[model samples]
Target: MTISLSKDEERDFDREIRPLAADPRCQRMKRFIQHGRITTYEHSMNVAREAFRLNREWHAGADERRLITAAFLHDYFLYDWHTHGDRLHGYHHPRIAAENAGRDFRVSARTQKIIRSHMWPLTLFHVPTSREAWLVTLADKICSARETLFERGSGAGHR
Candidate 1:
């Protein structure tokens, strides 16, 4: 079955996702994007889009809301991992993102787990248990890494 959001459903998605994107915790992310550093919004959208692509390609029957929510908010912490001092982001940001997400959104248990465990083999120490969670995690990594690399290359000669 091909599932796609209608215009009204897309509007609802924007309404639901925008508040989280506008939160104070997420402000740092917005600022980064505004400064042409890297875009949390774009990165997030890419992850969600990529996840949907993967699902369509693999014919994976995943919950669309859970997958999209997890993909969009996976890096809700909005901190620059490169400046974490001791590289704590690999082991810390997931918890921070999860806590903030819990406070801001009525996240499902599975969605929360995906947010909390997306940093697998690092802080999570375990892989995501659900297909939706796993898809979000993989999408997050793919998007984040690509963005990070692009930013690094573009900024290499400037700094």
Candidate 2:
């Protein structure tokens, strides 16, 4: 079953994501698929929500703004990786995402690290070096598994 956010959670989520969401480039993700059955927009939303929840509930001492922004931007690469098959998406998308984010937003170095390293073990050497980066990485994996396995129907990009 799908979980719905409370009003307060929804408000906070909207507030935190407003800057990124306001951009047409980021908004276009609503049409791009990620994982198996979710849009990149949905997948990134899940990661940002979970990363915020973990930081708030667990008191991870990470920079809250950076965590939320980076989580949202961690998959901001604009293409459907499934169709663009020349390279391994998992191994390379983080860097591409970081580049896109840097171009589209005023990202801090920590935010860049968070985006570049969220792929974690898949990327090997691109390790998460900050508390925020670690949270984003873990949250991304969790959200990815849920999107890939539990969600239904491929997103609009496949069609």
Candidate 3:
């Protein structure tokens, strides 16, 4: 989890990550628990950071801005799905998130598509079509598995 970032890379990350991370609507994600103790905001950040790193490390020629933006907004469904909203959260949230992203962020069609496909086979028909989408999907599963299994310590309380 501790990837060494060069100064240039750090700057690039900040440049790409800061605005969306700082958005008040995005900030609202801190109110919802995602994994055991992790906030959706934190989870989204993990996914975005990991996907960005993977894009560079794997030399996956994804557009950095689109990749980073889509990754952060992939889970932008803006609800506490565990307690409320649709029971089939897994199957529907990607579409909701993508819609929210489109309305609020005016993301490109490709970026919206990436956000929509992050859930992959669980979503079945909404398969990821681009390297960027696949990278976000992979990073999301990796971060979620780690958080769901390991971050559920007794001390980590829901806000």
Candidate 4:
């Protein structure tokens, strides 16, 4: 069964989500929301929502605030990976996002580490240690893959 958040829970999400989504970097991300490419905003929201679902399933005691924040900002680097004309995104985007997040927001050390290590065992060369980080990593891959498939016009067959 799917768990649904209560009205108050959704209110809490709006409080935090609105501010972050309004941030300048995220505003830039919004422009790509309909660029015929999978957007950062869409990817970030999907990851957060999926991670929240997974957290609920595991009965994990992770802080919801941190999990949402990390997932939403995980792809804050805001570049089109395809247009980069290189595969450097697999190696570079996380660090770029972490640095920008550090500068633009008052993020926790844990959150920063989550962002920096989200590409783990690939770009990071190590697996994440925190429960939230692991959740975000898994959610990122799941959401990104789905979005990629959707963008490729193979959504019906793939799903």
User: Best TM-score goes to which candidate?
Assistant: 3
How many pairs of residues collide in model 2?
0
Could you tally the backbone clashes for each prediction? Answer: 0, 0, 0, 0
Clashing pairs in 2: none
TM-score, one value per model: 0.71, 0.88, 0.91, 0.81
TM-score of 3: 0.91
lDDT of each: 0.68, 0.84, 0.89, 0.75
Candidate 4 lDDT by residue in tens digits, 105-133: 87888898898889887874646889999
The 10-residue segment with the lowest total lDDT in model 3: 150-159
lDDT tens digits, residues 46-142, model 2?
Answer: 8888898888778888887888899999999989888988478888899999998888787977789889999999989999999999999999988
Instruction: State the lDDT of candidate 3 residue by residue for 1-159, as single tens digits.
Output: 334567887899889999999999899999988977788988898898889889888899998999999999999999898887677999999999999999998998999999999999899899999999999999999889878867753355544
- Determine the backbone clash count of candidate 4: 0
RMSD of each: 5.8, 3.4, 3.0, 4.0
Ranking by TM-score: 3, 2, 4, 1
The runs of at least 3 residues in candidate 1 whose Cα sits more than 4 Å from the true structure, single-residue gaps closed, are 1-28, 33-36, 83-86, 152-159
Model 2 earns a TM-score of 0.88
Q: Model 3, 138: alpha-carbon shift in Å?
A: 0.5
How does model 4 fare in lDDT? Answer: 0.75
Off by over 4 Å in 2: 1-7, 153-159
lDDT string, candidate 1, 94-125, tens digits = 77777767777778777878888887867646
lDDT of 4 at 106: 74
lDDT order, best first, reads 3, 2, 4, 1
